[model samples]
Structures are given as structure tokens and as C-alpha cells.
Target chain A: MAYERKIGDTILSVDQISLAFGGVKALSNISFSVNQHEVFAIIGPNGAGKSSMLNCINGFYHPQEGTITFKGNTRRHVRPSEAAREGIARTFQNIALFKGMTTLDNIMTGRNTKMHKNIFWQALRFGPAEKEEMEHREVVERVIDFLEIEAIRKTPVGTLPYGLQKRVELGRALAAEPDLLLLDEPMAGMNLEEKQDMCRFILDVNDEFGTTIVLIEHDMGVVMDISDRVVVLDYGKKLADGTPDEVRSNQAVIDAYLGVAHDDAEE
Target chain B: MFYREAGQFKTSYRADQGILTIVQDRFVIGAFAFVAFCVVPFFINDYWANAILIHVLVYVLAALGLNILTGYCGQVSLGTGGFMAVGAYASYKLITAFPEMNFIVAILMSGGITAAVGVVFGLPSLRIKGFYLAVATLAAQFFLVWVFNKFGWFFNYSPTGMIVSPPREVFGFLVTGPQASPEARYLFCLSFVVVFALAAKNIVRGRVGRSWMAIRDMDIAAELIGIRPLEAKLTAFAVSSFYIGVAGALYFNVWLGSAEPTEAFDINQSFFVLFIIIIGGLGSILGSFLGAAFMVLVPITLKTVMVDGFGFAVGAAKHAEVMLLGTLIILFLIVEPHGLARLWQILKEKLRRWPFPY
Candidate 1:
């Protein structure tokens, strides 16, 4: 599968990105762009390189070929910390909240990059260090309130229900105030009500913060309902890229989902 | 009603994230500080001060160091005594070489020397974890002590491999040798412990501290969140060793006024410090102090009661004292796995809800 399109003022441009694990090619020459403030959904079957793409974007997996240019900056070797410092935040497919820490502390950990104070001031518990801590806490609290998780502020994240733990993971990413947010299956394993709440929060984050969201979602219904643009992939290659209606109507996509039309029916 | 944060609203983040937000906490800490610095010094004579205060201060430093590695960073270390030996021997060698160097600088420099040794031993930590890492550090415990003992140069080639204290003075007052007054030695150890303990508190609360806690809670998650584990782990080792080394230096210089390789840094010292943290609380500054005091006081209290208060023979009392300490460690572990710190938290919790059982 292959695709080509011009996005509106691209915020991230991936040109010929490829990756391999041992002798197997996980992603082969994949390319795409995510524009500012758009809900760009990457939909694909299992083993279609969706997670590999996300790993590349967040600097967890360094691509063997091509460039990842974010806001006009290109780098071959990027660390997760560098990506975070450059205003990219992400949640894992498997939730990775700090188990021993409170939900509030977990979110506050996301603000690690934004915090500026050193050890001296923290020891004294005075001056600039105290002021910086307070400022970060203010932002973290607002995120907690925004997600309506005030009741579990001091609860250790490990003990929370799966849905709430996922919410906490999202709140942590939000606490970073990233320019681009990559969410890998944000509604995975969630019931209908929890899914609905998460969808609303995702939209609100985009609308309120003007954040660009690149999400990998398995639920086609939710993807079709929320995505401004969709990119389809099959077996590590792009199958289709267009608006939801165009991708839904594409012959290849229809055949992939519904199988090829019978000659007898055509006769 | 008094202990609750219910009506004390925090409109600002500063107030919300403070170490002590409740008014009662502030008052309590203030009172504790007052007793430690002002009241205790007045009542104790020179002998008691030298015997108790100096020992307590030395343990406090060692405990603080162990807390950084095991408590804050979540790296279990069993080589604390080895690092202390490095400091003790290094200080001994440094003073012997440069007899005119200031005693404080020599002691602190010995801590720096121990930090270097700690980093070398700490390298194995990257490839292992938990009990494996603990065993890896045990290698440092045996190897370093053996090297110090084997090298006669550390003890100035003394026949018995023991380093006797050279004269040490502060502002022209003798403070380290046998002739030095116990008061001067007690005051010296006290001042050093106070300064470094405060410094340790600061390091743990800042970026370094948060990074350590992050690593402790979850290393993979911490790395994904942008904390480099190697840097954090190494820093914990270096700082932790620095504290342990200083404690070792003081142990020899101030308290014993003479040191042997077998005694200064040994397996028992490692277990002793580790027990203090376990019995006090892991990952807490106050817990380190409480734990150190508890460990030091328990055996002495037992000995005094058995031998002095009652009329038990000295040898029998000593045996019973050891048994009692072992029993207390087991009891503390079973009843409160979080150590004395958790007990402190429970007491505070109850005080907060005064006149209400719940």
C-alpha cells in the first residue's frame, strides 16, 4: 500500500522512515505528516507497524532510513528526553504510571522537564525552588481538575481501575504541555461510558490547547467520528490516506474489509 | 480539628506542595530542632557526650548515606561499611603524608576518595537488580576491606596494621588525639553531622531527589519520562559513599581515636546501618535519624537496665542485650514493615484526629 497527500501546514513530516528488528522488517519506508490542531488517526490491522510508527515519533525506536522533521527540525538520533524537551508527549499502549507514586505525583513527574530548580533551594525549602514547585503543582492540579480526578488525588496509580489509570496516564502527558500529543489506543479496553468520556477529553484538549493529536485507535467507529483525516495501513504499508468518507469508500479498503466482489454477482 | 488541612485552603501551588502544610507539623519540627541543638548539650557530661552523641552523629551520617542509595534510588547496597573503610584509610594516609593539612579538609577529602571507589563498585548495579545487586555490592564489602588490610601503607606500615590518630585541632584546640577533651570531639562530630544531614535533605528534595524516586518506583517508566538511570544511580552512589566515608572518618578520628581495618569498615557495620534504615523508615530523612538513634540506644538501654538498674552480671547482660536487639529488629519488621517512620506517621495521624478514634 502507498499514499500521497499535502497536509495543511505540516507540524511533523516523516520522509521514508524504515525500521527492522533482527532479520524482520517491522516498518518499511513509511511516510506521513500530522498538521497542527488536527485529529490524525492511524488505523490499521494488527502487525501493520502502527506502534512502530509511534515509537519512531517519540524517539523510542530510531529509524534506519530517512528523516523525522518536527516543526522544521530534522534529527537522525533523538532520545526520549530530547523529544520530551522539544515538546512531544506520549502515553504508552500499556499504561506506565509510576506504581508507588500517587496519581498527583505521577502527573507531577510529567512536569519534570518544566521544573527549573536545583537541589540547594529544595533542601532549604525556600526561595526560587519553593516558587518553582508551587508553579508546577498549580499546572498539575489544573490537569487533575480538568480530568475530574480530584477524588483520587492521593491514590497510588497502581490501585486505580484500568479506565481511571489510563485517564491518569493522559493527565500526566497533558501536564507536560506538549505541542504534539501522541496517544496509543487511549480508549483501549474501556467500556462505552469511559470511552465516551475519553473522546470528549481528547477533543477538548485539542480545542482548548490547540494541540496536534496523532492517535492510533482500533475502534473504527470512534476513529470515524473524531478524526479530521485518516491514514490506513496494511502489512507495514500505507493503504489509504484521505477524509473518513473517502477512505471508507475506497475500493481497496472496501475489498480489504469486505473482500473482492464476485463475478457471478457482477453478471 | 487541629491537625486537619480542611479549612486551611491553598490557593497557590507553593502552599499546596510544601513539606509541611499543616501548622502543627511546623510546630513539632521546630520543637524537635530546639531539643537537638540546644537542650541536649546542656544536660550531658563530657564522657556521656563523647560516648553517646559522637556515636549517634556518626551513625546518622552513615544512615543518611544508605537512605540515599537504598531508600531514595531503590538500589539495595550492602557495601556501606566498605566505603567507610575507604574513607577512614584514605584520611589516615592523607594526614600521615601532609601532617600540616587541616583535619576537616582531610576528613572531607577522604569522603571524596570514597565516592570514587563507590562509583567503581556501583558499576555492577547497571546490569543487575534487587538481591543480585545486593550480592554485587557484597563483593565490594569483602574486596575493599581485604585490600585495605593487606596494604600495610594505609596504616603507615604499623606492625599491627592499626592507624593511631595524629594530633588534630580546630582553632588551636586539640580535638582528635587521646589528650583531646571529649567535649571538643563531641562538638566536632555534631557540627559535621548537622551540616551534611541538612545538605542530604536538600539533595533529595531537588531534581536529583525526584529522579531517584522515579527510578525507585519504576526504571523503565522513569527512562521514558526523560530521567537517565545511569546518571541518577551513579549520583546516588557517589553522594551516599561521601556521607558514609565522612562517618568512617569521624568514627576513627573523633570516637575511637584509633582505627583497625577489621573494625573501621566491616560486614557488621553494613548490616548495622542497613538495619537502622529498615527499623527507621526507607526513603525518609527523619527516618534515618530516628532509626540511627533507635539502633544505638536500644542495646545501651538494655545493658544499663540489666547491669546497672538490676544486678545482672556484666557478661550475662551483654549476651541478653544482643538477644534483645535482635528481637526488637524482628518485632519492628513484623509489626511495621515501613519501620519507625511509619510509626511516626501513625502517631501524627492520631494526633491530627485528636479526641476522635478514627
Candidate 2:
């Protein structure tokens, strides 16, 4: 089947992306697109190259054969910093907040790509540099307030509870002011209450900023509940892509998750 | 209640984002600055000023440099002395080649030279990290020291493989060679240390600093967040080596008045600086200064007590001093892996809630 895709409406267009390490191919010609301001979810079984897709999109990994076009910038080879500069921000599969630094400082680091002051200005820490820092601080403080981590602003992130640490990581990604946000398992290891809270924040972030969200999630319920569109993958290949309901009914998607039938049907 | 920030409203973002939002921290920092720059100089005698304060100042600068690499960036380097030797020898050559050039310019030029060399050694960090990277830097230490000792030109072609200091002056006042007063040297070293320390703090708290911390905390994550590991890591090396080189120049031109490659750029200097950072606090600017002071003062105090005061033999006292230093290092690591800096932080926290132990 063939379908027409809108140009400007698509925030990220990945065409025939493949990545291989030595003898084993981690991802084989995976292709997908996320629409602007839409909540897109990539769901697959373990080792289905879900994280690898996000990594390639964010420039952590360069695909051997593919084109990743984001916000009008097309590149065969793109660096992570360049991806970030092009308004792409991502949280890690594992929490990666600077352990030795405070939550506020960790969030502040997210503003680093935007900070323009030189070394001399920073050293003096007065005039334009101080003004810039204050502006960044205000943004970071707003994030802290939004996440309800105000009390732990000065506390080192390493000492924080897992849920709060995840919140802090979200705040950091927000600090980048990204057009497309890649969140990898934001509610991976959380209680029901924490999961609900994170879901609310994610919805708020999407609604308030109109940021395009791409996420890799294991929880089918959460994925179906929040996602506007879903892409299912199996064995380093795209199994199906459409509205959540459309993918939910697709036989290939079901087969990927429930396993292929053996000998027609079970007795 | 007095430390509360309830009534101190921030009318602007500038007011809200200050390093010290509370009045108490501002007052303390102000008082501490006054003591360091004004009060301490009056009480410090010529001998202590020359031998102790000057030494402390020099080590402080070097520690700040090493702290940028090992502390802020999380790239554990064991080659501080080698970088420092590059500075000292570079400075020696600069002065010898251009005898009439300003002494300050020569020292800074030496720093530039060291930065170049540091970036060269730092290239290996792109592919290696942690223990393996540390070993790579150790190679820089051994290789550089060998070059300096083997090449006569580094020492101004001196027959004995040592560069004797030439008489140098700053704005009419003699500041180099043996004739320079300790007060002059102290002021000189103090000014550079203060400027560079402030610079280091700014860099660490700014964009470059964030990139470094990001790389240190998680390289994969940092890349995803838009920081190039190569750019950040190399910048750290260049900046760190620049400061270390300046400290080395001062160590030779001002402190020693004569420099040998082995003495100026030896591996022991690297250990000494590394120990200062470890015992003070890794990744802390204040910790660097505190660590340097502790490293410098403890041995002098031990020597005084064991030899001069108690009349022990010189050799015996020296041995005791080394043993004591080793024991203190182990003790500090065991008691607080973060070092004396964490101890100071704990004390401050305790005092913040004083007269009522929660």
C-alpha cells in the first residue's frame, strides 16, 4: 500500500535508515515519520531497535544508509550537537543527571546549547554574562516549579529519589527548548502514582508548548492512552504504522507481540 | 529564622539568580575575601609569606588547573607535573630568547605553549577514558620529562642541565632571580592565582563547564543532549594545561629561581597535585585551594614538631612526614571519600543549624 505524507507537517522523516555493528545488524532499513505537535510512540519487543531509532534521530548514532530530515535540515551524517542545535532534545534510557551537581545546576546545563557568553565574560561573571545566566536561571526555575521539585532545587540530583530524578531529567530536556522531544521510557520504573504524575507532565508539556513528542515505551496502556499515532517494530523492521486503533487491530502488530501462528492454529 | 529568604523578594530575574540569594552567604564570602586579601597579609611574617603563603598560592593555581581536568571534567589525569614542566621550560626558553620582553608576557606565552602540548596529549582521550585514559596521560608525563632532560635547549643549553634564572623586572621592580623579595613574589603569585581561579570558576559554571560536567557524568547522554565530546574534552585539556603551565612558569621563574627538568616536571609533582585535589574534593573550586593548603601546611607543621621542636634527626623527621602524609590520605579517603571539602561542607551545614542539633 502507498500513502501520501505531508512535507511541513512531518517534524521528523526517517527514510531507509540502517545501522550495523561488525557482523550483526542492529537496525535494518527502518523508516518512520513523526508529525508536528503529535504524540508518536515507537513500541516493540526487547531488542527491536526501538532505542536505536531514537539514538539515530538524536545523532548519537549515524545510520549507514538513510536520510533523517528534521525541521528542513537534511543530512546524511549529523552530529548530536548539530541535532541539538536543530532543536532536538532527548532524555536517556537511563537517568543521566550530573550526580555531583544540584538539580538546579543539572537543569541549567540543559540551557548550555543556548548560552552564548564566552570564557572571558563568564570569568568576570558580570554585565552581559550575568544577565544571560539570570535569564537561564529563570527558565530553569520555571521548570523546577512545573515539576514540583522546588524543594530539591539545591539538592544534588544523585541523592534524589528515582521518580524525582526522572522529573529532573524531563526538566533538563525542557530547558533545551526543543521543537522535537525524544523521551525514552520516561515512566519505566515508577509506581502507579508516579506514572500518572509523569503522564500528566508529559501531556502538559505537549499541550502547553505544542512540542512534537517521540517516545519509546513498553507500557501498552500508557502508549495507547497518550499517543496520537503508534509505530510497531519487530526484528529491526517496521511492522505497522497508523493511529493507535489502526495499529492495535493490525495482524502483523499482533503477531509481533503475541508470536506467529505455528501449524495453522492451536488445538 | 535569620537565614530565611521569605521577605527578600526578587523583583527581577537578576535578583533571583544570584550565587548567594541569602544575606548570610553574601556576608560570609565578603568577609572571607577581606581576610584573604587584606587581614592575612598583615599577620603573615616575611618567612611564612615567602615559604608558606607563596607556596600555597602556587599550588592553589596548579590545583585549580588540575581540578578543571580531573574534577569538573571527570577525566582523571595523573600528569600535572609534566604539563607544569612544559610551562617552566617554555618560560625559561622564552626569556632566554627574548631577554627584553615583558616577564608577564613571557610567562603567559609559556602557558600558551603548554596548552598546545596538552591538547596533543589530550587527543588520546577521544578514544579512551577512565583508567586507560589515565595511563595514556602517564605516558605524556614520562615522555615530556624525558624530552626536557634529554634536550639541552629546553634548559637554555646549560651544561649542567639546569636553567638559571635571569634577572627580570616588572614595571621597575625586580621580581625574578634571588634578589626579588618574598612579598613581591607573593603578591605576583597571588594576583595571578586570584585572576586564574576566578576564570576557572567562571568557565566551570558556564557553557564550557557544563559540557565538561556532562561528558564526565555520562558521555552517551551528553552527546544526545547536543554536546560534542571531542570539543568539550579537548577544551578542558587546553584550558587545564594552560593554568598548569602558568603555575609551572611561576614555580620556576619566581619560586625556584633555577629549574631542572627532573625537579620541575617530575612525576612526584603530578602525585602531589593529584593528592591535593583528592584530599580537598574532586570537582570543587574551593576544594582545590583547601586541598593545596592542607597538602602544603601539614608537612611543614609535621617537620617543625618532629625535628625542630622535639629535636629529632632531619632524615628521621623527613621519613615520618612521608608516613604521616600517606596515613592522612588513607584516613581522609576512608572517613570521607569526597575529602576535606565535604568535611567543610558538613561543618557549614552543621553551623547553619547551630544551637539545635536535629
Candidate 3:
């Protein structure tokens, strides 16, 4: 590993977060901090509220009680679009690619935040609008090349395979050039080879672009292999937070995953 | 062999991103424009100009407008007739009030006024979508026609309750009212269609179009990716209405010359435009033109074939034409739900891979 990236101060920190829907609690009092340029993984069982946490960070969900601090700004109710403008991007658990659009267009949409030309100028498609579009197309082409999906660039995303769709989803998120990338189960259903490719791409993105990654994955092998730090959640509460080795060694995390003494654990 | 792009490599993104990227496509468009502007007017008699071509061109604009909202942005609007009425009446008032104003300026201003009204009607789109939004726009259609019918100010308090285009001239050429030559009216409508259609094509391929499509495909993801649903939906409404408004102005002034609100901007007109997009193709600029032509030509073709060729009575032929058009529309929807544009695309793909489709 010749990558020599330095870990910097905290880029995103969640404090005293509690999310509930009427009677049921989704995430309660969960707290974690992610360092800049580091790969952070959140791992838990099916009902651990991992996706809800990502939604809150990206402003899709408003936590009943919490403050999310990103870069230096602190806010409680940031909008999804506003969060994207603040350099936060995410991919959904289920591939959310625009079914009617080509792979290239889907990726180009990630550059929406970067584009500023209004509808009037767009209608003319000359001068500023043309220049802006071409410039962004170049960036999007780079993402397509990096993901090695040039063959399917013109194909509608709905026509692509599951693994390819996931990769395209990643390409779309990358085209935004965000500082913080939240990936929900990027390798949930991948084969060994596909998983290896995704891991390499994720590591390379972290190294080349210095993007701070906060991902949720269920695979223990991937979490331990790539993540600099890991957090464990169970039933909407934080159980452990430390470097991979420490979290792995923690007895509570082991009991939570192995399901030992379930009756005693509830109390 | 002619349609393939095998050897036409685009060396730059600018060239690749052109509205007409293929040489053959560009040549085809150029040829069509030449035929339309140079050759057609010389041969266009009163019968063809007044009965068919101008009507097709005007509806093409309206179809393009509705397509922007329903096809591209996925906001189903049934208020097209109302929006067009706004344009027609607005232009009538502008033309009558400022008799010195150019018709082009009046038409453009009419489009602006309709865009504002469209945005107001489009506010409900943010909270509703799909068939629900369709219902909301349906309400707009009825409300607008009712207002125009109820209020005399819209029709300028005419004793006959009809709004008429005053005779207008551009550079000494009559363009409006009874004195305007059919050729002049044809050319006038032709110019607007050409420019606005090109502009529509440009808008749909750029960033604005992508945002609208994004919002259409999956709004939540679109919002998460930084597209404001408010801006995307409203802009779609505004742009769509602008085109419809221009079409409305042309429909009233150039095509009809005089129109009563109830008779002219009724619910059927809205459905007529909706059918154009449905049969032509949703979200396709070419589809708008194809759909409009299909809509306008079918009736004339039926009349010519039934009333003239087969010697059927005119009244019987008219009834048969309506039944046949309904059946054709249903058959088209069944055969290719994506519309004529998709069929055109499939044909091109096959042609490109000719000799062996594999």
C-alpha cells in the first residue's frame, strides 16, 4: 500500500441524535465522529437503523433531537438539496438510478449542483449554457471512464444488470465531487469479484480525491479490511465505536452479532 | 446506408452535443427547412394553408408545450386549453390596446403572461403528482374557460362575446385579420414554430431538461442530488405554458380570426393536445410534431378518402372519421405506448445496424 493519506480532524459529527416515527424509535441517542479522509463503516443487524442515520446526515430525515456538524457548520434541519450543496452525496440501498435516462445522463445529473445556467440560457443552448454543459460533460466522461462503464454509457440505466446499476449509482454520486460520500450497502449483494472491484474503487476514491467516506455495510470481512474505524449499532442504539481491531475485540459487539444470551441482552 | 454514423466520429464534445449531431440528420433538417420556407409558400393555396398546414403548425406548438410538462417533467397537465385561452385573450388585448406594437412582440408577451398563469396553476404539482396532478390541471382547464366566458373584459366586452384579431401588418405585409393573405399567415406561424421548436429541443437537452427528467424519474433522489423540485416543476409549467400561449395566440389571431371563449378554449381542446403527445411520443420534440401532424392529417385524409374517393356523404364521412380516429389512437397506444418517437428511434437503430442487426 503506497497510499500516504493523512487523517485530519473530524469532518462530520453527530451528537445526541434521536429519531422516532410516532411510537417506534428508529435511532436513539446515537453519536459518532468521522475523521477527514478516513474510511468509516457503520455495521449492525437488519433493524439497527443504519439507513435512517444516513438519511438524517443527508437531511432526508429530521431527527427529533440532534445536531449534525459538517465541516464547521452545525444544523438540525438541513434540507436534502441544501446538504448536497454543502458537498454531501449519497447512494441508496436500492439502486435509485433514473430508469428513463442513459447511464451518461444519470451521471451528468450528479453535476446538477455545479451547474448554474438558468432555463432561458439553456433554451438558447449557446455561449454560457453550451460552455457549462461541455465542461461538465468532460467531468462526467471521466467518471464513466473511471467506472469502466463506457460500453453501457448510452444504454438506459433500467436495462443494465444489478451489479452494473450499482456501479453506475456510484458513478453518479462521484460525479458530484462531494467531500462526504454516504454509501448505503454498496456491496450488499455483490459477488466476490464485484465486491473486490467496489472495495478497490472505494479505496482509490478515498486516496485520489481525499473524500471522507461514511458507509454502512453488513460484511464483516469488508468492514475489517478497509475501514480505519468502525461503529456498531443495535436496535437504534450505539453499542461500540473504535478502530476495527478494538470493535472486533469488544465482547458486546461479538454477543450482538453471534446472538448469545438474547434474553439477558435486552435488559 | 444513409442513416448510419459509423464513420462520423465526433472529435469534440461540442460537436457531439449538437442538436443534430449526425450529418444525415442535419442534412435532412436543412432540406426540410428549405422546403418549408422557400418552396411551400409559393405552392400553398388558400385551401391547404387555411385548412391544414397552419392548423397543424399551431397545434404542434401546443403539443410541444404539453409535452414539456407531461412527457419531460412527468407533470401531467390537462389545463392546456385554458393556458392557450390566456395567451389568445392576452394577445388580443395587447394587439388592440397598443395597435402600434409588433405582432411578434405581442405573441412573445402573451407567452410570458401565460407562463405566469401556468406557474400559479402548477403550485399544486409540488404537493400532488400523477393522476392527482392531472385532476388539478383539469380543474384549471374548466376554471379558466369559465372565467373567460363569464367575464366580458377578457373578450373586450364584445356584444357578440367573441374576441377578434385586429388587422395587423409587418413591414407592409398583412399578417392578421381578414385582409391578411393565407401565405403571410402561414409564414408567420411557420417562423414561430421553427424557432420555438428549435429552442424547445435545445432546452430539453441541456441541464434544465436533465433536472426536469430527474424530477420525473425519481423526485426523492433528484432532491437528494441537489435538484430543487420546486424550481424544476414550476419551470416545466412556465415553459410548457409559454409554448401553449404562443400557439393559442396563433390559433386565435392567425388561424381562427375570431373566437368565443366557450366554443374555442373548451375541455376538448385540452384533450386534443394531450392526445397529440400521447400518440406522438412523450418527452420527444419530434414526437410533438409527428403527433400534431397525425392529429391534423387524419381527419383531412378521412374526408378526402371517404367523401371524395369513395363518394360517401359528407355527414356520414365526418362521423366515420371520428370513430376511425378514436380506434387509431387506441391501436397506437396498444402497439407502442412510448409513442411515435420511440418507434422512430427503433427504426433508426435498425437502419444503423442494417444487413445484420446483431
Candidate 4:
């Protein structure tokens, strides 16, 4: 609410990232930056190293040569956990929700960084631990409401339908109150209704939380509708980067999309 | 319709997050504790106390430990007996080394020491999981027993090569050694069961517990979600070992009073606790208690029936008991791999949805 629909200074920058797996370059000299309170989408075919770029941003993969800067903190070697603590949260393309746990528990786990109770307090489960848990429970409950997944709050995520599971995964990432939310195919495998719901939640999160978002999606209409800036990747190289219309109309992106003529989706 | 929470309303987050939210569940738990604390101590004699209750309680604590690691964290440890031995030896050394040490402090220190050792053995878990991790824990079990057996210092150089729990008083009540009364010893061990059980309940209800469960379900996802695997796994090992350590100390100080390492904490003992978790239920605190009871009672019942009710020899009855127990454990695994806990849960769920035909 503080900055309504405003995309500010760069919150995250990836410079000269080149990730290779033993002589195979997965990404070659890739670079991109996402602004504050903006929805940035990375688009490419399956092997465009799009997911690899997101991984490098979150410190899951240390690119052979590059620096990832987040919230004014830049580093080459930082743990994924450190990235999380620094308020960078992410979801997986494959829906990495803790399967056996309840939806509420899965989201509350995302609040682990905010919970500071030590083992002694936790062992007692009174005083600070109880108070801390109550505080976070409210937050998680709100997330459940926002995602409209109140019915599955107590059900194990493994037992839920795929679309609801993806919603729960987003609920988990959002529970972190992250500065930059990286969603790897948040709408993957979703039908039209689910995709619409996910798009709404993503827009709501960016607007209400004033959170920066970097997501990778295969759906063209969803991407053009939501993403403020689009990064097109092809064979581990940054092909084009601009607003939705600019990238959509670019010849290279058109050719890269392989003449499917997705530029019409912007209409 | 019988098991309903219809009238019980929780308006606050605190009430909503209770260990047992339902009014009937709390009432049942309260009644159980009341009987254990007030009623059973008065009616129990030496035969019942030593033969069943104390053994069950100590194993309850140890089972809780293994359950936390293997059940909650999904680490699948087979070294509970070894960790318990570490606790027993540590307590012996602490008490014998300093006679003036308070029994409670001595017990806690023993658990702390065992926790340290547990963390060491838990390192292999980072590199391996499932059966291989279990084998690593088994190695820990053997190595700890060997250390206690080979070293004279653990046994205080006694010719028997065994450590004996010296007489110790808690609040002027003799609770250890030969001179202690069954009621006092039983009460002391029960106190441990009550306190640690509460602590375990609390731990499992909080963030630490969630992290363990998260790690159990999926380690990579857990790590990405900011649940540190090293911290979560090691803490599970340390805390679980602490519970098992206290159980071991109580086993030595209050239950057995003295014991040789090899006989006391063997691979069979490890299997015994493992069976308790498997039979009782993995990842259910209630399962550990159910497991301990099932583990302790049925065999004693079998042995007694074979030897006393029938005309079988004591040794023959023991063999028959072992065979019967093996069969029962297999039957339990086949019937409900989640253990009695899941069965109990199914019953409760059915009860909640009662008055309607299936």
C-alpha cells in the first residue's frame, strides 16, 4: 500500500552469470535485473536456462562467474538459506510442498525465519514459543484466506489436487513476506480457472505486499498480462529484455518463440 | 456423533494451537495422567512395579527419542540402545566421580553427554539416508557398547566389570540402589516420564517439531524453505539422544540398579525399541506410549502364560515368548505399518463420524 503499482529501483541484479556443468554451459554470460514492486517474468523454451537463472538468483546454483545482488547485498557465494533469511522466497516448478504435513504447517514452516524462539522455549512450548507461534498462526491463516485454500488447511498437501497444491505452495512462499518472490512455473499444469486464480494471487501479492516478483511461466497470455518486465532467454543467452509489448514485438523473441506468433496474445 | 467438538469453541489463536484442541481429548489425557500419578502408585506392589511399570516407562522415554528421530524426522536410527548406554555410562561416571552431585543434575548431565555423542553419529545422516543411515546408526550402537565394555573406567574398574547405581536420594526419598523402595523408585521414574513426555509434546508442537517433520517429508524442499538440514537433523539427534539418555540413566539408577554393557544394551535392545516405534506408530507421540506398552506387556504375558499357566520350563517359555513376539510384530507390521497410533486414529475418526452406517 505504501507504493501502489510503482516499480522502483533495482532490487535484484544478475551480472555476467555463466553456469556450467563440467564443460557444458547451461547459461552463458546471462544478466538481468528486477525492479522493486514489479512482476518480472523469464520466458524461454524448456532448455533456455530460465530456471537456471532463477536458481542462480536464489543462490541454489553458484554460477561459474557472476554476482547476484539482492536488497543492496551482493555476493557470489551465499547459501540458499541465507537468501531466504534475506527475504527472498521461492516456489518450485514441480510443487515442492512438504507432502506429509498439513497445508497450515507447510506455510508456517515458511515463517521459520521470523520465529526466533530457541530450543528451551520450544521445549517448554510456553511463554515465548507459544506467543511466537500464535503470532505466526495469524499470518498463516491470513495467507490461507488470501489463497482461498481454507478448506485444505488441515489436510496433508500430498492428498490435495494439483492446482490446490500449487496454491498451497504459493501460500507458503508468500507467508515469508518475501522482498522478491521467485516462482518457478507457479501456474504449471493448471487449467484455465486455476491459472486465473494464480494470476490474481500473484497480482494481489505484488500490489498488496509491495513485493518484487520474478516468475518463469510457459503461458504467453498469463505472462504478458502480469509481467511488468520480460526477460527472454534462448540457449542460455539473454535475447531481449523490456516491457511486455517491446519484448512481444521483438523479432528475435518472435523467432525464438519459433514462429508460433504469440505477439498476437498481447492484443 | 459421540466424539464431537461442537460446543467447544476456541476464539483465540492460543486455544486453536493447543496440543489437544478438543475438550474430550484433553479430558481423556487428564484422566490418564491422574491414574498414573495418583492412583497406580498406591496400589502397585514390588512385583508389578519392577516387572512391568518401570520397564515400560523407561522404554517409553527411549521410544519417544527414537520416534522423534526415525518417526518425526524420518532418520531411521537403529542406535537408540547405544545412545542409551552412553547416557548410562555418562551418569555412572558423573555420579561416581563426584559423590555430592545432585541426582537430577547428574541425570540431566548424562543426557547432555549422550546428546553430544548422538550428534557425532548423526553426521552420517547428512550423506546417507534410509537403510544406509540405519546401518551407520547400528555401527554407533556397536561402537558405544564396545567402548563401555573395553574400558575399565566406565565400570570404575570393578572386578564384575559392571557399573552399579549408587544410593541416591531425591528430596530425602531414596530412589536408587538396593535399599530404595519400589514406590519411591517407581515414583521417581514416573516423574521423568511425566516431565519428558510433556517436554516432548511441547517440542513437537512448536517450530522445531515442524522443521523435523518438514525434513522428514522432504529434505531438499525443507532446506529451500529455510529449514537448515544440519540444524534440524542434528537437533533431532541431540534432543532425541537426550530423551534416550535420561531413559538410560533411569534404567540404570532406578530400574536395573546395575548392569553389564553387552547384556544391557545389545543389538536386540535396539531392535526392541525399533519394534516399539514400528508397532506403536511412527511420528505419533501417542504411538510411542502405545508401542512401549505393547512392547513390554505382551511378551511378559506370553512368557508367564507358557511357564506358569502351562508346564513348560522357564528357558523353553522364553524361547516360545521370543517366537510369539516375532510373530506378533510381523502381524502388526502387516496389519498397520503406521503402528497402533494410526489404528487408534482410525478408530477415533470413525467414532467422530459415528451414528452413520458405512
Task: Compute the lDDT of residue B140 as modeled in candidate 3.
Answer: 94
User: TM per model?
Assistant: 0.88, 0.93, 0.98, 0.96
Where does model 3 exceed 4 Å of error?
A: A262-267
TM-score of chain A of each: 0.93, 0.94, 0.97, 0.94
- Winner by TM-score: 3
Give per-residue CA lDDT, model 2, range A10-42, as digits (tens). Answer: 878999999887776878888888889888999
Model 3, range B1-358, lDDT digits (tens) per residue? 5488878898999997787888888899899999999999999988899889999999999999999999999999899999999999999999998988998999999999999999999999999989999999999999999998889888889999899899988768898889888889999999999999989999988888999999999999999999999999999999999999999999999999999888899989999999999999999999999999999999899889998899999999999999998998889899999999999999888887777866
Interface RMSD of every predicted model, in angstroms = 2.1, 1.6, 0.6, 1.0
Which sections of candidate 1 miss by over 4 Å?
A: A1-8, A23-25, A46-48, A63-67, A75-77, A116-125, A150-155, A159-161, A251-267, B1-12, B96-100, B171-174, B308-320
- For model 2, the local distance difference test gives 0.87
Q: Least accurate stretch of 10 residues (summed lDDT) in model 3 chain A?
A: A258-267
lDDT per model, in order? 0.85, 0.87, 0.93, 0.90
Rank ordering of all candidates by lDDT, starting from the highest = 3, 4, 2, 1
lDDT of 1 by residue, A75-171 (tens): 7668877788788998989988878778888888888878766655666767787777778888988999999999999898889999999999999
Across residues B208-310, which tens digit of lDDT does each residue of candidate 1 receive?
7877888998787677677777888998899899899999888888888888877767899999999999888999888999999999988888998999999
Best by lDDT: 3
The candidate with the higher lDDT, 2 or 3, is 3
- Model 4 DockQ reads 0.72
Candidate 2 Cα errors over 4 Å, as ranges = A1-8, A22-25, A260-267, B1-32, B39-46
Q: Give candidate 4's error at residue A206 in angstroms.
A: 0.5
